[model samples]
Target chain A: MKIAETDPFSFKEMRKALFFLTFALMVLGTWMTFFYAPTEVVMGHVQRIFYFHMGTVWAATVAFTVVFVASIYYLVKETAKWDTLAYCSAEIGMLLLTLTIITGSIWAKPVWGTWWTWDPQLTTTFILWVLYAVYLLLRSGAGGRGKKARYSAIFAIVAFVDLPVVYISARIKRGISPVVFGPGGGGIDPAMMQTLLVVLLGFTLLFILLLRERIRIMNMETALYTRGR
Target chain B: MKAKLKFIVPLVIIAFLISWLVFAGVRDSMVYYITVEELLEDVPDVYGQKVRVSGTVVHGSIKNELDESLQFTMADGKEKIDVEYDGVIPDIFTDGVEAVVEGSISTDNIFVADLLLAKCPTKYESDEARYQRKKG
Candidate 1:
């Protein structure tokens, strides 16, 4: 509790401003997804889900990347703060990834005619989910600090190796998943592209907000434990 | 540093091994689907063996049977195969869309598919102008 008062990184005003900014962006993103973006010609209104699907996946990608970076920093600096950052980001990443999978499955049922399939992209994504879920389980069970944090950080770093594979699997290999962006992608309409960008930006801001809040709570817990000692 | 390596070395090796196993396993048997050409190349071997094949639906090759069965020709540019499916067809299924069918090839060379999945278009477009034109 004392650390919460004296913590140099406690930018209360900045966090408040971020909360309003994320809220406004999310409102705008939702509006654009439903009202501003035109109905997809082929998939009809069902394609509206694309905005949310992209948003969750984008945020999840950022979350996992944060975990990977924080884990490396924790290892290098041997700091509890960095480990806490890694753990918090991983937890958020896992939640966002689960949302991504759920939204994708909902969209898939009508578009792909199946709830799930083990396509290359889906397979890698499922593996990524499993790997991170295991990381969370391991971290929770490992307990304490020092050696436990070190092991968990190592696991996080190792788990990150699957992220890129999940990204490129659809492109390099055969899969039912569509390639919508980059290199061989078929691209989207200009208006749809604009809407997607707004949603992506909103999700990114939401992710930062969640990460900051989670890290703040975690730091407080650490401070309380240290004080009790 | 030596103490760190004592733990890090085994961790790295274990990670490498797990990754290798996953990628290798996927490569060997976990491919989402084979191409029409690949399926055709293994004709006799693939016959009656359930497999999934992906290809673009040949334009104007779709036929709807009265029994709710559907028939279409799928092409991978290099090879084309006849596909007969009886299932809930996906909404996006139409001419020029990519589709994956899971079933076994019959002795007469038709793919009898029990599961059919249509890939949504990679390029998303709004035909608002066309819709307006039609309305006008």
Candidate 2:
């Protein structure tokens, strides 16, 4: 549970700095999206939704990739820190995944002319959301820490397996979902791509900040529980 | 260490097998998009292949063949393909609307689509622009 040799004030200052940076970067990303990024010839201003939509998915991918690796390490090493890291990442990944689905759906209404479809990409993403949500529920709505951690670690691995499938679902078989990368590459403009990369970097910072804060809280709670026991 | 090794070996093998099966299954079922040009280049070659062809609906080429069946010409500037569909046409389906039809070309060179999807016009104009257009 010992996070640093530095004093409590230093930790507080670091958190404040991260919070300010994350907020400032997010605002800057938004400004660039609306003004700097040219309106897409095909989708127009509505295409602006693409920045946040893809950004959240990129960040969620980072978080879940960590969950997959950490869960395996936890199983082998039986370390509490690995399990905590997996759980924290899964929580943040799930929140961002929800945002991805919601924003994608909003953009879909004007672009695809439908609010939702059972397209492979959409379906696989939904399944992932359910899987991670169950991971969280199993952790809290069940037995002791040992049992819950073991169960959730296995669940995290199973859930991570779906990530690749969700990514390639649009390319697989006859589906209406657009492909951002592949043979055709969807013909994205260079300016739009630049904005997307900027937003993605901003969201990545936000993800790291959120994961650190969540893990600190979890470690404190674990410390309290062990002391009480 | 011996017991841990025993547990680890089977887990790795099982994971490998499962991933292989998933990748193979997904590859077999993968449906990809193609342009009108691509579809025409190999009508016989692509015939019966489960495929999606996207293009703009040719202006005035739409003909309501019956209660459910409709015929239209889909063009992507370079080429055009005849598409026949018997499904609930999307509200956005109209002349010049961008569309992607999911099905395959028949031996007769008609794109028999089971699902017809009309891409909506990108909503980008500001309120002022829209109002000026409307007023004009």
Candidate 3:
């Protein structure tokens, strides 16, 4: 495992393979969403944005979950690799979450007739975004490497408590956000669901590819800094 | 393994406490966006609590009262409520359209709303679609 982490040959080859896979899947998913999926009877072409919107959200959730787990593992093992994993995942999670919010706002303007609302789902997601953004700032501002890792791990765990709340907010009866999944709800067209699933898979692959590259970049930066010092 | 378990137990307890706190927070802050019928069915004691209710604006029941205030009757096909709001209404708010009003019910059986929101009806033609239709 250490060899795999530090050795350049196999890791670089793996990243290369993931890069191609991510690219291919992304193109195919986008094409499927626009061409294969039927136009929604309600929102028309704007409704097609749901695929990308949901894809990024799910991808962000996956990244955050990794952050949470890696944080916990880092706390237990006190390993730099685990800390690096948590940091990279959090960075990627924040990027995907930003996309999710942007796409959600765009979708809301046409369907909800408003670009923003303080509904439970939206509010919680916004809070999570802020929390993660602060986490990144805290890590960067902390001077020592050990202090940065420890503080960031704690923040990652604390911020993750909102994940379940955000996921279920739309399903709550009082939640004004649209419920895409519930009893008597989430009855999506089969083709639309297929497109969403494909896009989600593509996004997940893209996330993995990005995470690997980020971790590699961070490792190089740390080595360079240490040598400079 | 033993050392890890020692840390894990306390973390698990802390996580449990945090989850409970979240549940309580959500329950306290939740304000259901219910229809007029649901609001009517709710106990009268709930009148003063902050809540959100939704219904179709009764045709011709809207009056722009003094100081940008509105007095309107909204119905859910079964029940209706008189709503008094003091604010700029949403652009999509109109007669027969569904609107969600947030605030509380007053003792006088009027919904005192602080915020108003409306979503465009789903079946309506989008702007792009309308433009395409005109060009065709």
Candidate 4:
């Protein structure tokens, strides 16, 4: 394969394509997450958040996984690109995670008697939010690239591994998680299941697009750093 | 390179389009609500699936395992159903109050509620939020 040149300001046709596709995906995802799924007769309309919940959580899972790996890779390789990728992934993931919390809270308020709960998963997600907040803080502080990558990577790896377990136990472990496995008998109806699938797919596609754009940006930034030196 | 979204963008779009297709296949599995009488009429269809059952709390049927859990039987004049819950019973859940349970029924005929909701009569307001207006 041909080596990529070091260029700070770069654009790619393929990347642009991906962005457009992602735009389409966002449209499709919103439609499916909102419209395709059937409303709960009991919960009324607010249950729509579950579809968004699934989508954002799925994106969060991928982002967390990337954070874990990139952290390790950055530590070992001490490469700028890996750290950059980790930063981008975490930033975007946290944004989606924030959406998850917001939508989840609104969904819960009317149904769960409050907007927040004391469940392990709910608490963990809150903690993850804090950790990422720390990550952002550390990134901006006056440290060389080496120390920044070393510490943040360690935190990222630890946090990523714990996210899923928290999700499962919280989702399935009744009396333990806020809503239990199936609050509202918490499982999906056939119509709902159908809508949820579409939303999930649309979001998946959107993720692919976003991920590509982020990676490209990382690559371009890496090129500039090498060129400067 | 011509700044164009060529093969790269199309592949991504196609992937998302495919996900939407998969969702379409499973959408029919979604279900809806039916009355207790309707549920009784078609127990086989609703056996162990989620649903919303509405009725009055059978006046004397209230049982508080409220120490550990709470159980009660609800009826819509003609049909009676049992409900058990293990969370803080909403303050509004009491005798003669109207309630709606969101959950499924078991083979033995108890409603395994995941959510319990109740509405109080006369909309009590000894002390109320800014949103309430007191009666003269």
Clashes of each: 0, 5, 0, 11
True contacts kept of 2: 0.19
Assess the local accuracy of residue A115 in candidate 1 as a C-alpha lDDT between 0 and 100: 91
Candidate 1 lands at a TM-score of 0.89
lDDT of each prediction vs. the true structure?
A: 0.90, 0.81, 0.82, 0.66
lDDT of 3 by residue, A24-127 (tens): 99999999989988777556688888889989999999999999999999988898999999999999999999999999888777565568877788888998
Per model, how much of the real contact set is kept? 0.73, 0.19, 0.16, 0.00
Q: How many residue pairs in model 2 have overlapping backbones? A: 5
Q: What RMSD, rounded to one decimal, does every model reach?
A: 4.0, 6.8, 6.2, 15.5
Which is better, 2 or 4, measured by TM-score? 2
Writing each residue's lDDT as its tens digit, candidate 2 over A1-229 gives: 4555455557777888888888888988999899988776556677788899988999999999999999888878888999999989988998999999999888887667667866667777888898888888887784777778876777677667788988777665446676665585445556666777789889999999999999999999989989999
Question: Which docking category, incorrect, acceptable, medium or high, applies to candidate 3?
Answer: incorrect
TM-score of every model versus the real structure: 0.89, 0.75, 0.78, 0.57
Q: What DockQ does model 2 achieve? A: 0.19
lDDT of 4 by residue, A1-229 (tens): 2334444235665566666776776687677656765555445566667778878877877887788788767766677778988888888788888888888777656654456654446765787787777777777789777877777876676555446545644444322233323453334456566666777777776766777677877788778988999
The stretch of ten residues in a row with the least summed lDDT in candidate 4 chain B is B122-131
CAPRI grade of model 2? incorrect
- Chain B TM-score, model 3, reads 0.68
Model 4: how far is A81 from its true place, Å?
1.7
Instruction: Give the per-residue lDDT digits (tens) of candidate 4, residues B31-67.
Output: 2234567767778778898777667788888887637
